[model samples]
Target: MHVQNKKRFYLMVGLLIVVILLVGFSIYMIWSDISSSNAPVQTASNTTNTANADSSQGNRTDITASQAITNPTDLLVLVNKTTSLDENYQPSDLVWVDLPGVRETQLRKEAATALEDLFAAAELKNLSLYCCSGYRSYQTQEELYAENVKTYGQKEADLVSAKPGQSEHQTGLAMDVTAESVNFDLLESFGQTTEGEFIKNNAHLYGFIIRYPEDKTAITGYAYEPWHLRYVGKDVAAEIDKNNLTFEEYLKTS
Candidate 1:
């Protein structure tokens, strides 16, 4: 009887220990789940996090050099002397631009459509506009940059041409426009022509912006490229126009 009682006591103690362990484990699991639930979620749609909104707010004109853009495919992706696209980055939706151009080229489908609308609008005004350049691959930009360096020297080339990955052409959202007034050349003189004036006044109406305005050279880190138009969508373009802001400034304030 004594041995049996000892055995029963041992069994009861073992059962209690097991119950305690199970309860502790359940509590730990519940705590772990709660902690997981309270943790912040990260997603690609979080543009504010990726765009470095704080840096933009602090130094609207200052761009961090060699900053890799997190949102490469976004229409608002900032590419300049400070920000660079990946060497391998290419727009997946590039389509051959079916428009009057100096040479055959391509643009992102959405940009291409906007360009068509812009050109059509210009035609209505009897302004004969031409597309001088559109999308350029990284390799093409590299070659162009090298040629510019060879032809014009490094200093002038730096002002005129973007280092390969830094070119907005790679985004397939920029187009260099020209007219007979400039003889189909991408020149600053284009800004003075009637065609140029029309573009400056009406481009934003069709979701494009004269990316490098004559007055914003210091902020843009480039020469006043009046021929260069960047697609930022109609609403953004209107806001930029109304505020007379460069893309960098618009993004900073936004």
Candidate 2:
């Protein structure tokens, strides 16, 4: 019948319209995803955006984690969120430290000697810098990270604690120092005290530099840890201090 055929024609047209709409939607979704994938990813840090400076070009550098250090024992080896030491790479020249109330008191022999000189120099200046921590193992760092994750959520814990193999303490060339002025605590307030000032000004003379400076969190990938000192030999330390450069910057030029 003509009327029956007319109804069937309308039904087919409606189904065809629905099919076209679904096909168009699928194409739009695929195109949107492809465009999004081409966009540059922003590396957001907890405190601020990690800056990638290129003074020569006077523009933001393309920041990326450099290749892992070939020799972890290199005196000036750089380690950070980007640069990581191997889990099995422990320093061969570690020596026990007898500093007061310090845990994990072992450092490379050369660094240990420099630390003693630094502490002695502080004492002569009537400032007491107490070494708190040094030389963490991969397992120890893993435990620390898990504990932090429990206390704070994973996002917060990532900001506060380094993941295993990502900590500089594993290198035996970094030390955390505190003073009685801050109740022997590793507090940012320590950086403002006379003792912290002495270390800040005098540490490079003893082959060490403040690993994280107050203004360098964007470059250092962590909050300012004024108590953390990394030994890179006095010449390199002095250069880093004089230029006001982060270890990341120093590595690029050095």
Which ten-residue region of model 2 has the weakest summed lDDT? 53-62
Which lDDT tens digits does candidate 2 get at residues 31-143?
Answer: 99999999987666633432321112111122222422645766766688877888898987899987664454889998999999989888798777788989999999999
Q: Candidate 1 lDDT, tens digit per residue, 1-254?
A: 35668878999999999999999999999999999999998777777675676334322322332232566777777999988888899988899999998899899998999999999999999888888889998999999999999999999999889999999999999999999888788889999999999999999999999999987878998899999999988988998999999998887777
Scored against the true structure, residue 42 in model 1 reaches a CA lDDT of 79
TM-score of 1: 0.74
Candidate 1's C-alpha lDDT? Answer: 0.87
How displaced is residue 240 in candidate 2, in Å? 0.5
